[model samples]
Target: MERLAKGRHHLANRTSLLRMISAWESGARDASDPYRLLLCEAYGKSPDELGLGGGTEHVRSDIGLAYLGSLESATSALGELARFDEMKHSAVILGKYMPDALNAACLDWLFGESLADLRLSGSKVTSQDVAEVRTMTENLDRLDRFLGGEQCRLMALRYLRERVVPALKASKTQAVGRDLFSATAILCELVGWMAYDTSRHSRSGTSPRP
Candidate 1:
């Protein structure tokens, strides 16, 4: 598979590629994006034919309503939610709220076990990173106030998905992890508020996307 990937100009470390292949085979991870393309090329099959693309749509539509138990889970959930919003799928944009799901999520959040300290091997997160996220969130909040949620929601989702999610996955000290989590929570809350505003406007038949 590494040789095949290399043939397709996708250079990756042999050990890492082997591990990724193992994960994909065992269903521990989904083959995403470039890997999906590479695998399709190597196997001469479409992503749907390879069973790699069918489940994502369902998963994305179902994301963001569950109670995430840890920082890692929270990060993954937030990333998926942002991706779902960014896709602008009409079904998701106008989907009805599930009262039962909201109740269950609230219960789980209230009763869930405390998150363990994050200690992953990746880029280090710092106070500066947390501050940057907070600053961005504040700016986006101002925009939401001035221009409305429909105008600023996508940008907020994009930043959260592209920048904040990766930072949440990076290595950080306990203190920094807490700070980062707090900053991320603020951003997530802002995004949720924006989503709510957009939904309300949509239901009133007054929301117009430009």
Candidate 2:
């Protein structure tokens, strides 16, 4: 907390700051406004990176709207889209719908160069990982059918951001990688449909096509 108050003259008392920190950490209170900014600075991370949702610096309003050139870029774009949707709660008013951009994205997808092979050193991605994502997509589809996409879209986005996107960077055989990409594409399609069901048509158009 001292680190957060370094140059500030009107600092809260140490005891009060400790109490605030305790409350924030315990989920008894949100770290709002100036405190949130202070936490971000002290940690050298954006609020979103710290799991504090309201920071505009890290929230790209146009995320996932264009066709990226490589697997790495596509993976990063997917993470950004999922994070934005999760944080904004499918608020369409904050986004613009560009049919032209969507058209270009689709054209690029159909005729663009194939993504280069990824052979990074990380956890090994196997056929089982692909199956798990497919299974989760199926279960989420069932939930969407019953509960509506608005009710369940956040869950799907969270899984895509937290689980599947990271797995895309992991080490995998060529066959496993192909299968994994196919499974992830199906999941992305489901997420897009869920966004559409919630009336986030722009979001549906922007989901990663890989």
Candidate 3:
């Protein structure tokens, strides 16, 4: 509350708050905009650069683990800031990692850790895994309207095959398949961005209404 209060009260603090919170999930350059670009950048690094993945041993040694945990708390506190809308949660949440520059030095605590835990637990939640939740999602039309079905499909596909695939490919375990699929699963929120960016309502400044 006090931290958020400081952010609310002071402009510099607000910016600082934004930077600090997002840093856990993204890095300094990220935590900004044009999101997918950031995600793409983050994809290029080897585990040596990120120093994550492999096995339970890696998870234990990860320095970002604590930061990732704090990020979950910060995300909840900054929920409003993270949410551009239901579909555009990319601006506010871990959605910053995909389809973008992606080279930032951050991890979206909960999303990253949960995926890690699933890997450690031997669950099949890979980056490429298909999510049943999205299949049953009711708000997809807005996403389709924003990015369009073709673009959205392409966006989702590129998210998997281009970015996360290489990382998974380098993995020594079968978790690569799961990571490919799970990485795709992480797109649900961004898919919501599809509802916003691809829809008529999203035409605010980009494509005005006729």
Candidate 4:
């Protein structure tokens, strides 16, 4: 109580503290964001590691609306996300369509498009391009294992915007196109995972509306 009073928390009074504790213990109320933050500070662990409500509860949103119809759309969405992250407006893109968008894109890659002849006048995509994308993705996966998915979020977006997406705009064989699109689908899932992590951490106050 004294620490809370000195720290300017709303639950600084002993009476309020007792009531809050009683509520939490009796399951009448779950801890709010502010209380969860204070508890995290007290425990010196992450919310998920501590099993806080932020980790246990699901965040609802319309992220499913972000459907990816082609490699072009995937690239554009990823570019937008990269720009948003740079502008510190990442929260804006984390909407309800995320899961659906990822699912659609993945399905497209897995069983949808056959990409028989991506005919272009300029230089055609070769095995080297596919290999490069695979290498970069593998590297990104390694980074995720070491640094956690959140750490790779911005870099993943940047890579998709600059490298993979641009490659999509270039002419490629049908086979090469298929490979590129499949890789792009995987990349979209990566971005979605990052978005999920971002949403988990930023979730404060009320749960997201469906």
Clashes of 3: 47
lDDT of 3 by residue, 71-174 (tens): 23322222222122222332222222232212222344324543232212233343333333244233344555554654653344344333333333343355
Order the candidates by lDDT, highest first — what do you get?
Answer: 2, 1, 4, 3
The C-alpha lDDT values of all candidates are 0.68, 0.77, 0.33, 0.55
RMSD of 1: 9.9
Q: Higher lDDT: candidate 2 or 3?
A: 2
| Superior by lDDT: candidate 1 or candidate 4 | 1
- The numbered model that scores best in TM-score is 2
TM-score of each: 0.64, 0.70, 0.22, 0.49
Q: lDDT by residue for model 1 over 76-195, one digit each (tens)?
A: 666665664555544346655665666777788789775764447778989999999999999999989999956698788788878988887888888987888788877877777787
Q: In model 2, which regions exceed 4 Å deviation?
A: 1-61, 89-93, 114-119
Query: Candidate 1 vs candidate 3: which has greater TM-score?
Result: 1
Evaluated against the true structure, the overall lDDT of model 2 is 0.77
> Model 2 Cα RMSD, Å?
8.2
Instruction: List model 4 lDDT by residue over 1-210, tens digit each.
Output: 346435566664678878876876575545554566677687787655665442232322322243344534444445544443433332443333334454654576577754233224456677788788777777877787678755587677677766765677678777887787777667666665665665643211111111
Clashes of 2: 0
Ranking by TM-score: 2, 1, 4, 3
Q: Candidate 2 on 61-178: residue-level lDDT in tens?
A: 5667778767777787787677656656333336776778878887887898856845477789888999999999999999999989576987888889888988988898889888
